[model samples]
Target chain A: MGVIHVTDRQGQRHTLECVEGWRVMEIIRDWGLPIEGVCGGACECATCHVFIAKDWVEKLDPATDEEEDQLDTVITHPTSRLSCQIIWTPDLDGLELTLAPANG
Target chain B: MTDNIETDVVIIGAGPVGLFAVFELGLLDIKCHLIDILPKVGGQCAELYPEKPIYDIPGFPMVTGQGLVDNLLAQIEPFHPTFHFNEMVESVEPIGTPEAPLFRVRTAEDGTTFTCKAIIIAAGGGSFQPKKPPMENIEAYEGTGVFYAVRHMQMFRDKRVLIVGGGDSALDWTVNLQPIVKRLTLLHRRDAFRAAPHTVEKMRALVAGGDMDLHLGQVTHLKGKAPVLEGVEIKKDDGSIVSVDCDVVLPFFGLTMKLGPIANWGLNLHENLIPVDTEKFETNVPGVFAIGDINTYPGKLKLILSGFHEGALAAQKVHRYVYPDKKLLFQYTTSSTSLQKKLGVTA
Candidate 1:
């Protein structure tokens, strides 16, 4: 079990009790904070954009190049990342992520 | 700055059906103002499958969804119709005589109000929007990596792209992204595709090509973290569980559309759709015409070709009713070219 800290674009922090190996998008969508995973956690739609916690950024794995290219097209901050690419592990118990409005 | 601009006609919803009205009316030398909630034109055709192929629309043998939009935009450009993008009509009330009742159309954007002699509701079945996945905590990976539609296919290029759903949207994307994305995985909860046979054939070919993987089952379990989509657990029909390391996941399940602001007008709407139709496309209220998906005509087909036919026909009918003094020109055909050309020529 992993307890990830997710913050919406509005700076609202959600204490998500997520299952290990579950994608981060699964956590936010279940809480119902208005993050439309239009693609349902696929890297195609890019509606599930979020910013990772700066402190824990080093601890997280780097995004693949393709995921990076997709991120450029979406309306997001420099720290933005697509949530579907992220998996839940017990390691980063306090991971912060912020919401960004969809590019549509 | 002006609250309203007076025109001979007002078209709500600047989608393909709405723009088609402008193009058709332009041919008749009729001026109209088009309104929609989108920031620009193209509507659903542009939004849904800009890169995907569309076979239903007539002409050119075949064309991409965006290609159809391009052709439509070209046709409507000559008319120089006024467009109020990102604006929606709150309500359309009729005012004046039977020959030409001036319409009081309220718009929320810019707070500008429009009053036209006639209103043509060329809004399609509705504006299409990406549907959200039902999974909890799905939004947590917002920027990280989650998607609905393929707004940017190149981004997933040279990477593992995992897609869910056995429908047309899913299969079509799988076929398109096969060459771009390094590896593609097609997951369907069913044994067969609901899409036409031709598309399924294309997908099967791709799977056989070895560039794509076909996982026939449900994603019963998901495994991931802050930076990597290391693996996913798929629940197979045979009770076997498979885990995959995916770089990206694209779900093309389906689309959800809204009835625009017309839903709030309170005009005896049937399920927020199905407005009462009197003749052709006229709604329960006079001077207020509902065309395309927004209207429940006796036997209206929801196809773009059909919607365009209904909308164009409704516009012409309204034109005659609005301007009794004007003479009707051109012998328009009510039967679809597909029907007429096929049934008449073939039969």
Candidate 2:
């Protein structure tokens, strides 16, 4: 199990807990945070874009090719990552990230 | 029965983008009637990914695709947008001239018609058609013994039914029809299912209880006469052919999106998407606005939030065509009393 802190676009923090093998997007969405994940978890729509907290960026699994391709079309930053690409693991507990701007 | 209706604007495709279009157009005092091939609203969000969370809708940080659709529906409820469900908009004809035009939209399933001042093509990637399994005689048996979609559950009562596919539809029908059908069998290439985990677990319980049979194989052949399917031949993983006796075959291979009747609407198309100007999102044809994923423009993004923006901009332009004499002054929802009154939040 792991705990994740998600900072939404409104600067509100949502803390959620989940067992391993859950997608970070699923965790945030289940908690009723702001993420559209329009293509579900297909890594197609970039609505699940999230900015990883600097400290936890290196600890998560690297994004796959498809996830990177989808991120290329959206606004990106140094810590940007698609939440669907990050599956939860106990080793990476205490993960923190911020939801990105949708289409502002 | 033929029903003739008149509206200020007729929005096609009742997805998130189309639902939001009603709100934007409603703000301009323009009434709308929405049509979708799906039986219900919330196209992809409701159909493909109802449970998936969407991160990028401006105000709320995260809402499920279906949740956003629900909120959009509630937001547009005050406007009272009319909805025509389970009907495909088959033809769009310019009854009036190029400059001051009126549109006559006709549906395929029922001969219902809508005459409108403007048309908003909010169809996301157009109509959805189910992908059929690779069986040579499948088409011949369609509507007789083989079916793609179940329109009526009573038609399947007490019959030996064979359902193919591993998606939500297959599992859903398996659970729903278990009590009605005389015997039911679910066949897939593997034991894995793409349905909800709880649903998958429930189906497994039913299978273990001998309530239904779960087979692992592909339907390689259909055994039936012309227009009358009798059974199917399955090729098991071990390379042996097993024949399952059944009166009906329902293949739920999922759906494919296509640019159906809108392709013949005389609008200029860039590839498969309707090309539109970024300002008003008007198609090459005047008085016809194409928003959502069905439209393409410079720096066009297919996200639902982007479509909402396009709907807002297009509504501004639609106001001109809908009410040419009135001058449209933009009003913010936060301060405009008239807007708040329309939203029923004026207290």
Candidate 3:
């Protein structure tokens, strides 16, 4: 089990508790956060974008080539990541991220 | 609820690629009928992001998704392809032998079936249905008070409506129905929302002015008798429950796209996508073709442009099985007078 801290575009914070191996996007979406997993975690649409906090950016798995390509279509921040690509584990227990502004 | 259709080609989806397929098939003097699960044509382009601008479509500098769909519909107007909206292609089978096969396509919604010489599966990401909330007795109040969508606004007028979720649908309806409804409550687990920021701002303004209520909690239990809804029990962040009077409950939980009845059809699938030869976009079954996003190839890119190219190539091959006796003569739309006439364009 892990808890993710998500700060929405409106600057409101939500601490979501999720099980291990759950996608951060799924946790945010289930709790009715601002994330729109339009392609349903397919990595085809970048609607589920989030900016990992500076400290936690290096903890998660690196983005894949397909994810990198899809991310190219969106405006990227230095710590930009697709929430769907980030899987929760014990290492990410207190991961902090902020929702990215939609490029759409 | 209508007579069975007999056509030269039956396109399974009414998306842009499927609409374009109608044009391609029409150029070869083939008649087509399209079926889609959406109530209208244009699939994801119109449904998901109609207002979203698409920059890569050929010939258009910048066309919104809906704009591209509109042009495609007009381009295929001369063909007069029949479209059956709100119907899904439930089953597809080869009627004849493998050498010379015909297809029989049926839809689950109604007994409407089609007999065709060739079948084109252009179902982009398959059917898009709203994901129902996972509450236990949610199904019991499905039609009585629970609704995934609002077909009409008047139904909620003068009623205590509780709108759940934070997506575009929920926010849009909350704002739209607040003015007419007797009491409106926009309930979510948090203050954060997924809708357009401007729309959210408007909703917040309304809440601040006390026009509607904004409660931060997740619905835990539904309170009502069978076929009549009364209220909902919400579990707050502090583990406290609050009951809100609600005559109607609209849960915009989101959508789930499945292959749907297409999976039952005997076709080779790779990760739920139809495996088709790149040459003709033909599936393992003869006379049956899969195109658009529903199909997968080694280098398949699920883009509208890629689907358009696949549709053109698939049409050429479909011509062989649809009219085996006629020799196909490929011609550009710019130079072919026959194709121009077919498009109702005369020099």
Candidate 4:
């Protein structure tokens, strides 16, 4: 099992165990983080938006068109991505990201 | 204000679970009227991801979100369940005793009232409201200089307006309101838009013709005082901060679910979900029931299948409250001709 680091809205960093094939959203939500993941990984809702660390942004696959469409619905950063779109794998070990502010 | 309508059951949502509850309750001769805040039924399935495929539904290996909702609507068609669309339940007053429960449910839009013996809240993740932007103090300008939804276009006539977002609402309003507003500006995070191509084309034509403004940025601050007119500060993608003077700002981000008036209904809420008995799925209130994602139990799984089971069991107990003196018998639709007749299917 690999591990992923997530920063909550409160700016507290938490390291969570990552299971293979699980979305980063599932990992953050399983660990009881404040990520909404409202659409349950369908990538329909942008509630699970996160900002990937600048260095780690290039390691992951680019966000798909469908993911970009959802991201357009919310305030996004250059590194912003829907955590549900980032499937966990061995290569993604040590990934770090911060939760986006909760949209009102 | 119209005459208060009387029904045996008033379902507070028209989602898949609420639609299924109509089928379960119908088998026991319980009539139902459903109310929803959305203009159409299907709740999250229709609103959030109608095109997304779902594979967990029984019998069907895979179906789109809207597909399941359509089938559920067809499944309960025989019951002829009445639906009140574009309405929200504002208040639920218990008008009867604990033994024989009765409630007067009122809606916000039209103030329609329904007196029912059983109330089923199948609201999945609560009511969907407009998703506000993350700007601080934006709430202070709500309904004044800032509006999430445009109820009256005349209110914006001759006013400087700033519309934010790349979606249809923003694009549509930008195109439609430009002709009326003194000056209109559309602010988006990126140059690309997810709205309809034709609408985007229209907005581009307006921008090209110098009829309005298009800025590639996000709103960073609201310059207006509480419920007053002013402008906004936008942070451009190029790290430049720009200010736009406007009388009104309309941000059409999207919709998010929130536990609205349900929190004031006096039911015991645990983290926005109503605690229900595993056996009946009824809320703390005797006649009021909570099913689907809105209700929590010992091992409640917020799956469509789990909600179907909850609706079926809840309907059984609801039959007890609706028809206290009538004896209920368990029967199967495959063998029981009486049950088959209720389903409108018989040899």
Candidate 5:
């Protein structure tokens, strides 16, 4: 099990406990943090967009082309990523990220 | 105005669940008309990810999103369901009493009205609309100096236009509108594009020839008063802010699902999902049913298979509304000759 720090749109931070093999999106959504994850972790919808902390950016695997394509559809920052693409692991125990602005 | 379309049932969405509802409702002799905001059917399957593989569909071991949609379309072929595409359902007003409920459904695009005895809200995640960037005061310029979709190309003739995003809509418009527009600028966050290779090639050719301007950046601010855009401030990738002058801004950032007008339909909503009973899958309002991902109940799973079951059960209750005087006899296509005939499989 690992824990992830999530900052929601309102700038409120919440630490969520997550099990391994679960996507970060599922963890955030299970904790009721307002992440849409509309496509149910299929990486089809960019509703689960997030910004990884600069320190932890290099700790995760690089996003695939498919994930990047989905990210192109939304207003993205330099650290923008679809949280669904990030799988929870013990190495990411204290991963910190902020939720992207909700798409209108 | 044309006459309001009269039907036994009016399905709000043309998604997989909506398509399956036609099969169930048709078996009970309930004719249906489906309305979708998209130009084509298969809602998210067709729009979001058509090629994505899906498992857990009861019979098929594995099927693509579009594959399941095609099979559902073929399975419900005998019903000959009427579809009104490119139309968003605007309002649903109950026009009948509680015992015998009827509804007057209206669409936003053409004001098309449908009067039906029963309504099946199979709209999964509401209606798909163009994704709007979360820019301050951007809504003020909508329909004036900012457009999500191009209804007419002539309106942009000889005008300075700025297109945003790296997807097909942005690249296609950049290439197509370059010829007519006095000046065209394409702005994107990254150097790489997610659009079709051919469309990207054409856009590159135009840029190479100096027909249009291409900038790797994102729009930071809309520089204009409400309803009249004079220019825009862009944050380039190199950390430099630049201002580009243009008459209109078109941001094609793909689509997003919104609850839209469904929230104002007087139905009880629990976090954007209609709470339904486990038995009928009907909403709090009589004669109006909510199924698929749009509905919530005890142990709801939001799976495609779960939606199929909800639709089948909902149809049984819909039969009660459409044919209250008649008795509903349980029959199966495997054994009942009448059911076989309804499926057009009489042997």
Candidate 6:
């Protein structure tokens, strides 16, 4: 089991029991945090975008070109990525993800 | 000049096609006044079904109607068109200019006249009137128990919410409210769902997870009185009444908003749709146009994708109507750009 750490915009931190093979968007919203998965994670809509801490970002797999293009359109404080593309695993424990704005 | 609001053009409907016309005409910097009866600019979309997903519209693979409307609003936001809502257009008469002719659009609610050089009546298939529930006490339940939108997600946060209808909108709403509402019950008049495949899959997953209940039949009656909606009585196909307890009732049976004012506007209406020329989507009335599901051309497909096709074509004609000298130059941008725009992901 992987333990994922999610920090919402309101400074609420949640340590969730990350089920294996679950997408990051599902894990966050399942815990009752706000994440507009508007397109239901079809990869067509970029509503479920998030920002991963740079230190742990390299530990995770590189985002696909499609995901990168989606990130380019989003307005982020620093950087943003689509949470639906990230899969949870045991090695990925302590993954710090931040919620993003809806304009992406 | 009775409360005269003058513009070079007046686009009567703020629908997908109507808004597209506004954007297209904006390229020429021709002023336009966009009016819609709904509280929002998106006509049928914002009024009829904001939650339903649109699969036919090209590009983005798939998108909710609300999502598509947001993208459309963003596309036309740069045009900066004026908007007036909650007011119906009562009449349209010629307000002749010394050099050219104009139209005086008189609205009913507020007797204000909007004068414009040209008019594009791109009303998408009549006013979309939502089919409301038959509960007599439903009015008393508004804000107290019932709602048209999911305004207070926390109200139904841990309660059973019953959704009526089997259409695309109904199905999409179930999926949307499923993760939010504690338990969901989808009551359909029929056993089938006209929603897309992905939405159906998600609902099926919810059902498998014991998070939802699917009641396949019609709602017979309401259970409670003021300040509460206890349960709904649904009559199954076998002539049996099944009473299911619920916190809130949502009717998504779709709209009955027929073409209310167009018949009086001097346009030929054939079978509830505006009859128009095949190539241009223009009505019998000069300087007027219609598009989308509300229109029927000799070869019109009546899809959102097709409406975009008709819209771009009509804009070119309207460009010619406004600027007779620029007609030939406007012809270069006249070809069908709907598929191209969607394919190229331009907008």
lDDT of each: 0.70, 0.85, 0.85, 0.92, 0.93, 0.72
TM-score of 3: 0.70
True contacts kept of each: 0.00, 0.00, 0.00, 0.76, 0.76, 0.00
- Superior candidate under lDDT, 4 versus 6: 4
The 10-residue segment of model 4 chain B with minimum total lDDT is B338-347
> Which runs in model 5 stand beyond 4 Å of their true positions?
none
For candidate 3, write residues B144-209 as lDDT tens digits: 799888988998889999998776888999899999999999887556677799999999999999
- DockQ for all candidate structures vs. native: 0.02, 0.03, 0.07, 0.74, 0.79, 0.01
Candidate 1 residue-wise lDDT, B1-347, digit = tens: 65668887888877778888886666555788988777778776676557767677877678886888788888677678998887777777667775556778888757788878778776665655555544434565444456776877888888888888766777788888888987889887556676678888999987787868998666654457744555567777676889877877676655555666777654667755656454557666556677666677566566778767776666676777557688966643354453333223333
For every candidate, the chain B TM-score is 0.58, 0.89, 0.82, 0.98, 0.98, 0.60
TM-score per candidate, chains pooled = 0.48, 0.72, 0.70, 0.95, 0.97, 0.48
Candidate 2, residue B78: Cα displacement in angstroms equals: 2.4
TM-score of chain A of 5: 0.97
Model 1, A30-71: lDDT tens digits are 877777665456465566778776787777788876466455
Residue-level lDDT of model 2, residues B277-344, one tens digit each, is 99999988899999989888888888888899999999998898889899999899999999999999
Decreasing TM-score order of the candidates: 5, 4, 2, 3, 6, 1
Pairs clashing in candidate 5?
Answer: none
Q: Judge candidate 3 at residue B76 and give its lDDT.
A: 96
- Each candidate's chain A: what TM-score? 0.87, 0.94, 0.95, 0.98, 0.97, 0.89
TM-score, model 6 to reference: 0.48
lDDT of 6 by residue, B74-94 (tens): 887767888877667878886
Once fitted onto the true fold, the runs of candidate 3 whose alpha carbons sit more than 4 angstroms away are: A1-104, B134-145, B150-161, B166-184, B189-214, B220-231, B235-240, B245-248
Query: Can you rank all candidates by DockQ, best first?
Result: 5, 4, 3, 2, 1, 6
